[model samples]
Target chain A: MKPRIAFFDFACCEGCQLQVANLGEALLDVLKLVDVVEFREVMSEKWAGPLDIAVVEGSITTKEAVERIEKIRARSRILIAYGSCATIGGVNGMKNRSPLEEIRRTVYGEHAHTFPTIATRPVDQVVKVDYYVHGCPIWPPEFIEVLQAALQGVPCFPPDHAVCVECKLNENVCLYDKGVTCLGPVTRAGCNSWCTNNGNICYGCRGLVSNPNTKGAMDVLARYRIPLELVLNKMSMYNACREQGKTP
Target chain B: MRYVTIPADKMADYITALARRQKVVAPVEKGKGQFAFEPISEGREATLTYIPTILPPKKFFMPQYETLLEYDLHEGQKMQAVVELEEMVLFGVHTCDLAGIACLNTVFSDRPKDLNYLIRKNKIVIIGLECVAYCDEYASCALMNNHLPNGGYDLFLTPLGDRYIGHVNTYIGDSLVEEGGFFRDATGADFAALEEVRRRKREVFHDEVPIDLDEIPRIFAHSLRTTIWKEIGDRCLSCGNCTNVCPTCYCFDIVDKPNLDLKSGRRIRVWDSCQNERFAKIAGGESFRKERSSRKRHRFFRKFRYPVDRFGKFFCTGCGRCSRTCMARINLKETLAQLAREYV
Candidate 1:
């Protein structure tokens, strides 16, 4: 029997789901391998229970998000975090760097009291993540590879190296040498060094590598005369939850 | 003939002639003090006086990505072994890069030989260029003894004041200059000029590091438990830049890319690096080289120690790309000097 796959979104921009939709011609191939029982973005019918695979996107930003994700985990045989938000809390976690009350007041203005907020946490913090497809909007190639691996009943490990590996393979001149401060040295790869290849600096949107040498990255920044606070602020853009080391 | 000469003015014509027959790859400036090996149709496009290109000539041989096989699942897993080959003349290659190519040849040609690399390597011709002066501060070619050519190329060129003296090492090199009609027999005066350049080169180039070359393996062997690994590791970003830019470091990973049909795909070999955290990991969830320090130590050992035991040769060509490309500013020569101080 073909494996049943479902994609769920919580509190994200939904760009990751769009990446799957934007698969273009390859989406036909993906359909041949599995049955898409539930995809709210594309179809109306939702599967009730007993899902073969559940791919989740976005962070748990509210109490309701936590409860929904846990319920989804209970019915799925394998749960894969499908983006930076689901795996590392993503840019949504930047609210965690500042006080929740201040963030709520700034965004909601006078209606701050009417809305309740919670510290952003990755899906893995609330429920076990069987696999991870990591990036800002999720690199489509990795998503397909992870799905294929899940169907084959094998583990698909992402490249645990830094983005500089892919950047060098592309033979792009080092951005640091171009007077640009980049987080490519410590940020996890699997995006094919996309930002750096396009001449933009790495903001560490993929989060730090498994064994990031942060001190070494800091020294590199210092050599380029880039300030520590500047890098810290950039890191918080997608990594405030991981950096804080808070237990849910 | 053992020696020939090409006047400085006629180099462009010779280059254009060679490009007419096949691809000619040479160094070209990429601005901001960087250069890369690119195909050129004119001699002026080749930067003959440039430093080592950002990536060595390895890209033409092994390439970053090469398809090994194509598979179709419609026939119950039918696969065809494939090799992508290119025929070309690699021009203006520095001696350090030549040594690097030689190191790769030894590795790929070893037991359980890689037919993919060997098959592709045979199609290209290598033309070497001598470096009479140091390229920059990062180079340790003199220390590694790779500054001088050691039988890795078909032809070698040494720049003189008004001309280049060429040493033809193979019949292919002989016929190239002969058929092109751009070179002439070297005269006695030309030989004297070449001798003068070599004589002065001895004075200009010396070991950049203080330690002797023979002591390197010994020092590395004893320093396995030393603090240098931690010191270097503390500054290493594990970015894999050092390995990717390294001319002699050749590790790779194999992956399959399926087409939109899901039944057809190509298996490709892509370059991998030891500096990656999972490079040493096994399927049992135990990674022997889990620490950043251990991975960094493994890189150094691969170049200085393990290759020596396995191949009886040092894999380091002293091209200095590792130090130059390192974001952490970890200098290879300085690290060697520290090792010499502690373990020599």
Candidate 2:
């Protein structure tokens, strides 16, 4: 029997859902391979039943989102954190720097009395996620590959290697070699170093590799005469998942 | 040891003959000192004596944009895993680049083998050329222990006076010698000439940086709080030139590009750099390395410290491409020296 699949969203840009639509024919094929019983972006048809796989996109920023995820987790055999938002708290987590009340007051002003908010967190922070498809808008191929692996009953894990491995394979010169600093060394592999190919630098949208030596990275920047505060800030981004309350 | 004397006259015939029998690629001059590896039908176009090519021979084994899989959405999302590879002979590879290929071999051949890279690599044969001296100031091969031939080639060639001393390293190389009809047994004088070249190379290539190799990780470890990162980060535009030119900087981003019909698409793994502002930022708006200094520092440690712990070797081949190509004038040698001074 085809595996049942579902998609859920909480606080996000909805780009990850749109990215799935961008899959085009691949989406149709995926639909055939699995029963996509609950994707709000593509179809209005909804089902309330146990799902074989649940792909959760976006981060949890409110009490409702937290309660919704728990329900989804209880009904699904496997839960996948899709996109940077669902897996690493993503950009929305940036609001975590400010107190929840302060954030509401800053954005909603007079309406702050009615607005409810909480510190943003990836789905994995609250509920167990069986897998993760990482990226700003998770790459479609990786999403498909993970689905295929699930169908085969094989666990798919993201590669733990750094981006420099792929960059060297592509034969592009290093940004640091060009007197610019880069984060390819500590960032996880799998993106194939796309930005670097087009003469741009890596933004580490996929997050840090397993056991990344962030301090070591800082030392290298220091050697190059880059400022400590700048290095600290760069590392602080998306790292709220790893560093919840620590400064530096 | 075999000594082969191909007069400048019969060189093209020999090259053409090799091309016909096997896939033969050689370095062709592309103006100035720049060279590229292209299919060679004749010897005249081959730059036998050239610096490291702009793109190393790694391209043949792992094409920049080779398709690893193809998918069709028309029928239930069907997909086929594929590898586009060509069997070829890569001729005249510099020692440093050959070492770089060796590094790649160790990586792809590791557990969870990259079948695409492995299979394609097996189809090609390597013929290494000895670099008697430095390719340019950008090369720090001497510091990295890659200045001399470390045997990643099937056929190793060393220029010996009027002739070439060819060391056939594999059965395939032996077959080429047997079929080419241009080789003669090596004489004592040929061996002497090869030895003399080696002796001269030692004198020509000196350590570019004064720090010892073992001291690199320690220096970086001790100097984590140094102000060097701030200076470099302030000046760096984060253009990613340094990682692009680096011999080993390999971060990537994977994307799915669907056809207009929206039925099928190919998953592409594109090169990515960490210098970009958004590299570590998540969709929720959080950034791991938000400042240029942190990103800049991350790049440095990857080369000097991180890889040393993981791969048991420095990822930096001392190929000064990063320093040479930097728009911000962030000299790698200068950075290392400063770290040495501050941390040592």
In terms of docking quality, model 2 is incorrect
- TM-score of model number 2: 0.60
Tens digits of per-residue lDDT, candidate 2, B272-340, equal 678755578786868898777898999999888887787787777765767765545688888888889
Q: Mind giving the per-residue lDDT tens digits that candidate 1 earns over A26-125?
A: 8988998889999989999989879999999999998988889989999999999988888899988988878999999999999999889799988988
Worst 10 residues of 2 chain B by lDDT: B1-10
State candidate 2's DockQ: 0.04
TM-score of each: 0.93, 0.60
Q: Which is the leading candidate under DockQ?
A: 1
Task: DockQ for every model, please.
Answer: 0.63, 0.04
Q: Which 10 successive residues of model 1 chain B have the least lDDT summed?
A: B256-265
RMSD of each: 2.5, 10.2
Poorly placed runs, candidate 2 (over 4 Å):
A245-248, B1-85, B95-127, B136-344
**Native contacts recovered by model 2:** 0.03
Q: What's the chain B TM-score of candidate 2?
A: 0.91
